[model samples]
Target: MKPGSLLARHVAPVPTSRRWLVPMAWFILLLMLSAGMGQLEWLFRLVEPDVREVIYRRAGFFALLGQHVMVVGVASLLAVLLGVGGAIAVTRPAGRDFLPLVSQLASIGQTFPPVAVLALAVPALGFGTLPIVVALLLYGLLPIVRNTLAGIDGIDPDVHEAARGMGMTAGEVLRQVELPLAAPVIIAGIRTSVTVNIATAALGATVGASNLGDPIIAGIVNGNTAYIVQGALLIGLLAITVDSVFERLQPASQA
Candidate 1:
């Protein structure tokens, strides 16, 4: 078959065992990271001997992980909506004039450092997860917006013309033709946005949002290497697992 049928291959059913493996592995890893960090309690006691063995007693590791996912999840959802929505709007004839402005705003949002955002936001929103969510949402927007715009714009004009020639309305063409062709690209953007935020969400620890970074921060404050290692390990694992899922979902064309 020609390369045109590649997308069909992309949607081919994954092995039943393989489909379950990723989620099961993800959950097992997640459980280990979130709750398993406590298993190091004995190790901490052995090393410290005198100091507070469990400096990370503020919350269980699993609790912090849940908070971490929550913050990143909310932020990524908002970014996807705003990013994809803005991209679609600007691509349309009615909003074409604002394309430059939309692109520029997303650019600025990404370039703006999370720390600076935290500093500025804390005064208005006060501490907690809200500011971090806002920061991550803004930071994560560029990829989705840029990818959406690129995906939609890269569509062959002939395909759109063919759709229109078939007596399809603009809305119908977009719904049935434009979006399917653009989906892979748009999803690529979403993958990037979500993956990046998973790491970035750790910044919430600095602002008292309390995620995986808690251990790292506490470790740093107390000069305890064990805590830092625990936090960093779990966060890294989470990133890798999530990125792997995205990798699987990525279209063959993206390859």
Candidate 2:
């Protein structure tokens, strides 16, 4: 009935359901595009008027998409486990001395570049998904480890003391207090790690991993602009979809 109520009604915050809907829409669009890429031949033909074959038919889009997701998923999972575990361990009394070493190693891992890691790993692992996964895992560790360390170390000393004074065991304190408070920062790190890996996973095609990057690589080799567009478009859509999913999860992490 008042001016404030009218203003509040006009400027309402978006509903939580609506926030999740965006990512769902993107995911559905990605699936639809992947399944129906052949249907868009005319569109690609416009882009590459000279090419006899505009559609990428060496492998199905869905299959390549799955491979891309799998590669990123496996690598990200391993990075999270190792990064968070190492960060937690280093923060403990017995492992404090190793903190600097672990941090330095993580920094080095990120700085060394995934392509270089792939070059080194492929020789020993001999190509395929293993080397790609290993490279991605190594490349993705720094963000998760750095964020986990920051989150855990940034906790107030008084809070830890209070948690201990409340008769909470060390394990319980970590599980209940430290981790809960740190979840948002940790999730942010994971989000960054995952999105970056999605782009990096494209490199796997060179090593015979067979992913969304296939089109781009093939296009480059054959000088087909259409194929490159297809690969780049799908990769962009996939990255946006995944990043939106993380956006939806961010609030949950904060809570």
**Best-fitting candidate, measured by lDDT?**
2
**Model 1 TM:** 0.88
TM-scores of all candidate predictions against the true structure: 0.88, 0.93
* Candidate 2 segments exceeding 4 Å error: 1-16
Per-residue lDDT of model 2, residues 54-168, tens digit only: 9999999999999999999999999999999999999999999999999999889889877898899998999799989998998999999999999999988988887777677
lDDT of each: 0.82, 0.90
Full-model lDDT, candidate 1: 0.82
- Pairs in steric clash, model 2: none
Q: What is the lDDT of residue 33 in candidate 1?
A: 58
By summed lDDT, the worst window of 10 consecutive residues in model 1 runs over 1-10
Clashing pairs in 1: none
